[model samples]
Target chain A: MSFRLALQESPGNPWFSWRYVQDNSDTILAALREHAILTAEAMLIATAVAVPLAVVAYWYRPLTGPILALSGVLYTIPSLALLAFVAPYVGTTNPGSVLIALVLYALLLIVRNSLAGLNQVPPEARDAAQGMGYGRWGRLFRIDLPLALPGIVTGLRLATVSTVALVTVGALIGHGGLGDLILTGFRNNFYKAEILTGAVLCVVLALVLDLLLAMAGRLLTPWSRRAVR
Target chain B: MRSENPIQQALTWLNDPLNWTNPGGILDRLGEHLWISAAAVALGCVVAWPIGMWLGHAGRGGSLVVLISNLTLAIPTIALLTILPLTFLGFGKPPVVVALAVFAVPPLLANAYTGVRSIDPEARDAARGMGLSGWQVLGRVELPLAVPYLAAGFRTASVQVVATAALASFVNGGGLGQIISAGFGLGISVGGGQILAGGFLVALLAMLVEAVLAVVERVVTPKPLRKARGRAARRAAVATGSA
Candidate 1:
């Protein structure tokens, strides 16, 4: 059937339409793919930055307050405003702008959680590790990091989920993956099918990512699970 | 304007005295932004706080709190803002308020539940032993102790509401976002200044609200709790040094 004929078969402004889904599956998948990739890239970079920053803060207690306060200030800036501010420097159409903004937004949770996790490492564990002749770096890897894994993972999960949600706002700059579809659907006569599809997929992506991270956290910290039993 | 640096252009736009006094000026938009944020956060408190407190007091609905927090994380604010106006709610402030209220609920609810749940069991027992009714225990003892958590929640909700309310302009709901959106409409080269100015205003407002609420949080927290926290911090410092 011709595209025009297929369009006519759908009722006016239905919230969902099988026809629309079938006809636009390629477009929908592309948007979803972009959204997922963007989120993953942003999270990867953010984790890399946050872990080291948090480690430094943990090592030098004096820097802890300022590090956290800076992230806290960054977190408070509205996503739209942050994006706008970044857009001028990076160019609006560049996905780099979104990636940079997302990373900044993710820093607070990951850094806070990382520091908290490090602090939670029992002092006795550190002392014991040191007594066993482990170097400072070796002790951090073997004793402290493993103990702090759960808290750090929790921060990653929170950051990933929020980044997924915020990525849609990147549509304002023309690169918001699923966000582009949602905004387009809104602008184009309130196309309910497209809008609902975009919204539902964003949530599903978030839920799926969160569950995967939680499971990964469990697997990475098997001793914690064993202790519960 | 094109010859000038973007920062210079933005400053010029911001400096325009006429922009302040004219209808739909910065002051007008700021008032709208504040009103919309306050209404949504107030509505959220009215709906979520009681439920959170009640469930927390009973020590039930732990899973529900988890569910709500996850849902809040998953749902995009932009999607909610756009979708609500399409429903029977139609356009304008009502849908914006509803959407923002939904946005505000999770932090408020989660914090409230956590605040109540964090209360020491011994405190509850002691209050009960002293002949306080269940309601009295919740009101006089539990609530007072939970003030810090509640205040933290309020601070979070308020700051978030203020930020997300900027999205209300998407549905023709009034707010400072109009400035940003309008600038976007004017194209980047021409409207760059306006966009920058809008971003600065929104960020400043959010930080101001956060700072103000933080003070409120400190003031509301009982003195004993404050002193105890300070002591704990000092102890932590000593322990860290020893380690």
Candidate 2:
């Protein structure tokens, strides 16, 4: 039985002719893996920068207003346009360029949340901590952070979901993800089933990723339960 | 065409009367774009409300529903548009509508669920104590309270769906997206202008919808909260004077 026949015969079968589609599947999956890694990388970098900057912003509110406003403006740039603008700078199709764009996008969400979460740690709480003789760092970690955990996690979850969706667009520049399958299926007008498969897989992946993140939120932020309740 | 430089030629091409008509031409297309987005949002609400209500009433696994909604938002609109026509065929409004609905649902669902869940326990208990049946309590007590939150969700979903549907033009689904995508293909100042015009129109429409929804939300919000905020302001002023 030929690979084509197998795909045709079992159009709905995710595993149909797995070996023949191995290269293509790998390309798609590898793109997805790279997307995950890129988001994780961007999150780490952005969080590291955003957390300290948030503290600075909190301490010197007037000075950080311009920066925050700039980030808000940057957030309005259509995602694809930003990617296209960066294409020339980094040369098109480079994963690094995509990651750079993702990092900028993530920064807006991360920074906003970091600031909001910090602000949410009531002024009185900070005053109380100070009066308790805890140093700023100690107070930040012990009291403020725990209180702000739910908001911070909410921001992270939002950023991660948006990143997952945007990374699929990276497929347009030859970075293959499940989106590559969908795009290729459309471009060639071949194998409608393949397109369906890709779309379904993309939806499934999103749902699973969301569930995992929600679980993580539940676990990491003990305070989230209180918020939910 | 041959004598002119690329920029000049592109500008000349764009200045063609057929393409560059007056206010009427632009307004007609703009109207069509607005209609499509508005219709899609309405359709999404119609579709989302039942599901949102069901999830909210069930009350168990409310967080899970919100999580799913967040993920639904994560499914990039372009990817969904690109994929929709493959299996569905017939490349026009239906696919665009479906895609927009998909984009719209998450916010709607999340808002509905949140609104329902956020109701004050005493209010819910009071309704129950009054011998209101479960359905009656939900319809009367819960939904009224949830209106502002749901409206907030609707406002978010409306803007999101409108912007996303504009991208449907990439699939030949004809909305503002066609103008922008063609502009991109033109790849010059002319293309840039067209894209800008199309994008600006869409953004304007989104802003208008947001403002309209803001008004609607204010109208729909419960009176108690408004009163509470008023009281808080007065108290704060009193405290400031004392200090």
Candidate 3:
């Protein structure tokens, strides 16, 4: 309550003016929190759906084309257009509209990467698993998924980063993460502090999340680095 | 009796001839969207392609590519555009162009680097053995070999940019997003039509880019390499099927 956005927007102030931090600390933090939460939620949901769809597509080869094609076409739709297109159907106020679009954007990356990761498991590895009496589901989870971890993580990283960026576009639909601050500033005669703060927070958030994901990828697949050494 | 569906209402409005002929009509919006996307892609190539080729040729700075790519992903372009006006860059097309250009770079860089790196070592050696300079080797051998990847990269970058260029409207850069944004203000029944028209154009732009690039990819891939690559792919498909 005390930390509402700063009242005085210094448009003439330098972009990096210290005044932004002094004035709009609360708004910046709130936007950051919202952005992070939405992005994370979207990625998690995308992964949940995409990974399984990819698995099914891999299992049934004929499905791959249709499955990937759907996402590919969806990917071409502009973020703004998609938001507006859905706004009528879902009600403009529904955050689900934005979340749904973000999820769609993430799907192609997630599915394609998951498939690539699964494909990366050498045939011999699969043979070894089968020979070792691993059942189908057991082998998929234990052998295939672990081996594909690096690839899947790569997809997740890509999707997460893009989602983080696109989530800002959601501001147009009333659910824009840090995008709201930027839009707020833009609408209110270019409130420089809000715009600058929003932009900086988004970049910082993307970098931090990207790094964290990379580290997580490394941790998940420790042996990936070993082959080089 | 006609349905008062918002989408239908919008379509009816879209049918008006005024939209097609006016100064701020659909055709103008289409032109703006195309120019913005094209400019972004062209500038992106100028900046990113050479860096990628250099990294690929050197076979170094792998981590540098990763960091740059991450930075590209992390920067929220729409937000960045809003901030740019306050900086020395000032407002309008410059900021929009810069943001879109930055967004377009990563794919080009990554693909160019990878395309070169994926060249056959034996082929590279033969080029060198034939008295080719490093640049000659790159131009004569690696460039042709990398055609498919380059096309693929361009296709991806262009498609994404075209879609993203819709955001230029937010900054008054003027593109198909104007229709969508305008539609939002016009309300559900009437505005929905404008939004649909804009989205349709943007999506069409992406699909067109993809289709053209796919054709170029097929045509420019060195014939022998394409045949060999095709065979290898078929073999892999067979193997996957059997497995």
lDDT top scorer: 1
Of the candidates numbered 1 and 3, which has the greater TM-score value? 1
| Candidate 3 global lDDT | 0.77
How does chain B of model 3 score on TM-score?
0.87
Ranking by TM-score: 1, 3, 2
Writing each residue's lDDT as its tens digit, candidate 1 over A79-175 gives: 8888778877687678998999999999988888888889989999989999999997998899988999987997898898889999998888778
* Candidate 1 local Cα displacement, residue A115, angstroms: 1.1
Candidate 3 lDDT, tens digit per residue, B1-243? 225765676677778989877998888988888887888899999998888888898898767766677677777878767766555566557667778888777777777777788778999999999999999988898887777667666776787788788888887779888887777766665566676676666677778877887678678776777765544433222211100
* Best of the two (2, 3) by DockQ: 3
| Ten-residue stretch with the least lDDT total in model 1 chain B | B234-243
C-alpha RMSD for every candidate:
5.7, 7.8, 5.9
Clashing pairs in 1: none
The C-alpha stretches of model 3 lying farther than 4 A from their native spots are A1-12, A218-229, B1-3, B227-243
Model 3 chain A poorest ten-residue lDDT run: A1-10
Interface RMSD of each: 8.7, 9.9, 8.9
Native RMSD of candidate 1 (Å)? 5.7
Fnat of each prediction?
A: 0.51, 0.18, 0.59
Candidate closest to the true structure, highest TM-score: 1
| Over 4 Å off, model 2 | A1-20, A23-26, A33-45, A60-101, A119-150, A171-178, A193-229, B1-29, B54-58, B88-90, B124-133, B188-201, B222-243
Better of 1 and 2 by lDDT: 1
